[model samples]
Target: MKTDVEKASVAMRELFAATPLQLNEHLSAKYGAQIYLKREDLTPVRSYKIRGAFNFFRKVIASGGSGKTFVCASAGNHAQGFAFVCKHFSVPGVVFMPVTTPQQKIDKTRMFGGEFITIRLIGDIFDQCYAAARDYVEANDGYMVPPFDHADIIEGQATVAAEIAEQLPEGVVPDLVVLPVGGGGLSAGVTGYFRDVLDERAFVFAEPCGAPSLKTSIATGEIVTLPKVDNFVDGAAVARIGDLNFAALKHFAADQVLLLPENAICQTMIEMLNVEGVVLEPAGALSIATLDQLDPQALRDKTVVCVVSGGNFDFERLPDVKERAMRYAGLKKYFILRLPQRPGALRDFLNLLGPDDDIARFEYLKKSARNFGSILIGIETRDRSSFPELLARFEAAGLGFEDITENEILANLII
Candidate 1:
């Protein structure tokens, strides 16, 4: 662990130096808490993943492990970080990514590794890619570099904590530390180091609401696999937490684990982008989103550190991000309305809408009906309260409608 930390610190110097420990005034004022962001997003790979990857390789090479053949399975930041490490160490790495992985991620991974790495798109999901990577590693007798769930990886991730400790004002320990959990390497590493070095600080673990592996593990006293997961917050949506990480995190209170709704996280992402000009992946925003749930009075004047996990967000996803943010903030909604089949029916319904309401989408589900037709309407409003007023108007006018915004089954098929 000591060696890995030392090597990670050294490797970081060779890259673009240290990521900034930036004080974010926008968040500080909003929460009434002194907030600072550990900008892992500014890392060379736009994530802290490189720290762990470099440490893993450095330790292996120092231990006489062959640098010629290394294997890993990741389609996201991990692959890019591993590729960067391979190039830095002059090692040959075979990276397996899911076939459905985005082209942007694939290109970034390749660009980081250059000629030192070979990427293979294996299967549709990460599990399949992981299995394929294991097979290759076993067959070729190559070293398997796990994305997380390894001592070296955890040790390398601890460097973030070390840096934070060093960067803070003298004799100051943050009141709270917020971390986003995927496989939990970063959280485990940071928490482990703090427990050993610092006096006391509350730790809050954030996970995607769709995939609360750490929260579930803490609740059940064992790691449980989620049967299904929403991949919207793809970065931190792990089905299960790492065994080692679970052990370290299991002692925490269940309430300490904050499950952030994927849509709600979008607001934080957009806020950071627009206000701070900071691009954050969904997982990166989890820590910031958790601040909303805290008591403003309790947090006032207290120093808080939130880890901004990664910034590998693809610009192509901007539309979806904006949509989710609006929906979560209640500024946008979708409804299935049974429109009366009358000449003046459309005019009447249109008149009922409030001044703040705008028809974002108006589509006929089926126009063949004579009595009534199902219309899928998406409404955007300047104020969220406008929805209730509009609903009241619809009620007085005897309009039949169903809010399909939160209906998963219907949304899956229609929205």
Candidate 2:
């Protein structure tokens, strides 16, 4: 029997040409490595998800399954990919998205599938929507094409690695390959192909710290569900690794996976946008952020390829992106201050600010006494070091304040 990787590559040709493997000079210079980006972000649905969707449907058809109706649960790029594939195969599909999904994403899914698909806004979270889709597919005798987990999906995703291998220059294999992990289909696929075809290339996986499903799974030797996940990086915010994907990835060392903080990812996104003119979604920046964890000297003369997974970023979130980047860089901060109820006290604190310091947010909480009150102050500076001088002035002047910049509870509720 032909291996799963071979089958995926065969199915991909029916959909479209391969995604580009272009050299990115800006990233190469920054990391001091000859870097190339596998531009999966440029896929038809703006994500590699379409590959798996197409493979699943094609396999179903090839197996002589008469089922023309397919169902899937997704709130993001996966839904778009499934919808597009459903249209491509001229098959009917039903997409179940969480009711909380943004209107923009819902509309995009509709546009991609057009008359070939029906959308159902079912539950508050993806888990509920997935359960609902499974129930519907079972009852209606429609095929339930999973966003990830199936053998075919893994196979389809592996085609990315196949293309990378074909696109590289003669006798050139990257020293390291980086991938962003969501449900693990893409990572498993690429890693499988790399190990099977080019055993010498090193592999690294990146997952959002808030949703470190793959890293956690590899560490515990079992797929573990996180109690909570930050959905800021919604594209790859999976709670657990896919069963099929974990099986493929089980052989890898635990240290090969990198967990990146969500805030730090924002910095990568902004840098890519401003420096390279790349508009990557939060999850798309995972692999890029992983580069920071690598030793520059170690990769100085090495060849590296990082998958820029998806660029389906909604520009409206740019303000939040900027805020997160600033917070992560330590150039901005929020503090709860105990201020004396005196006119000269405010003036003294103002004078303490460095030349580059600027007040971003200032609000009075409440007066505790005739001489003291609580204040919420947000400050920004050109450089992160400016905070030290600002804090020193607060100490020397005897001003009481609490830095709430990293306080998740207060930041979530207030900022």
Candidate 3:
């Protein structure tokens, strides 16, 4: 498998060169470790996904390529990769993407393939989209280019491990390899390669809290389908682990995987953007987000590599990403406040806020009664500590308020 991966890596040179493996000083300083970012985000499609697509196409085209069609379903990155490969091969392909996929990804996929591929918007999630693609393939007698889960796809992804091995400084060894998990292809491929070639293998897998298919399946020794998957980390939010993928990863203990909150992942994304000028999609930020969760002693002075999976973030979502980040860091909050229906009442509430507190949103829900009115208020503060001080003042002033920042139903409806 490692040799196959190496061969694929060599063949891939005909497409794009190796993605950079750079030492991230900002993350290294914060984690107290020698941290490096395996920058899969720098590939032609701004993701490592192109490797798998290209390899799959190369082998398939070599065998036969008369009138067969190719089809694939993806959340975003895979679609772009498949599209790029379709254009490279001049083969007719169709890509199915989640309807909820960011417009940037959908547009890029179309641009990459040009006349070679057709983009189809389907279903609400990858699993549903994949089912639709499978049905299409069956009905049309077309070939399916799986985003992950195939032996060829895994072999292609393993080339990342091959590149990492070649790029690391001579005589340097990584104490830990952090992988972001979606459908488990990258993790399985990379880990399988490491296990085969490296004497000492250490890995930490990160997955969205809302989607823990790998962790759940590993624990049960069987694949388990999730009841619900949060699509916030759309790139990594998979409902079920692939059977082939699970088989490659089953040897590892369940606890080796970390379930990261979506908000925390957003926070990491913002930090990387602001502090390092590195833009990352939610799933791309997963590996880096797990740094603070590790034992400080475990990371101190050790070498770590975080695979930055993709950077195809849509800037239009920046405000929402910042909002989630601020809420996670306690620097911003939303609440419903009850105030007397008087001109002076608004002034009184304003006075209760500390100097650092700024009203981000103010809206009056219909006046509940004659004397009292419900005001939906959102506050942004420079410091997290400001919230406690402001809350204390509100309590002393007898201002009744309900914190709705974490209220999913209410927050989604209004804020």
Top model by lDDT, which number? 3
TM-score of each predicted structure versus truth: 0.97, 0.96, 0.96
lDDT of each residue in 1-415, candidate 1, tens digit only:
5445655776767765777888888988888878989999989899999988888888799899864599999989999999998998888999999999999999999999999999999899889999999999889999999888998899889889878887888898898999999999999999888885544348988898999999998899899999988899888889989988888778888988988988889999998899988899998899999998777897899999999999999999998899889999999999989988889989999999888899998998896477998999999999999999999988898899999998879877877
Question: In model 1, which regions exceed 4 Å deviation?
Answer: 1-7, 197-201, 367-369
Model 1 steric clash total: 0
Q: Summarize candidate 2's per-residue lDDT along 228-277 as a digit string, tens digits.
A: 88899998898988998999897788888888988899999999899988
Report per-prediction Cα RMSD to one decimal.
1.6, 1.6, 1.7
lDDT (Cα, 0-100) at 19 in candidate 3: 93
Off by over 4 Å in 2: 1-7, 197-201
| Candidate 2 structure lDDT | 0.88
lDDT (tens digit, per residue) of candidate 3 on 62-176: 8886378899988688889999999988999999888987787788899999999988888886668889999999999998998788988888998999999999999887899
Shift in Å, residue 336, candidate 1: 1.3
Residue pairs in candidate 1 whose N, alpha carbon or C atoms collide under 3 angstroms: none
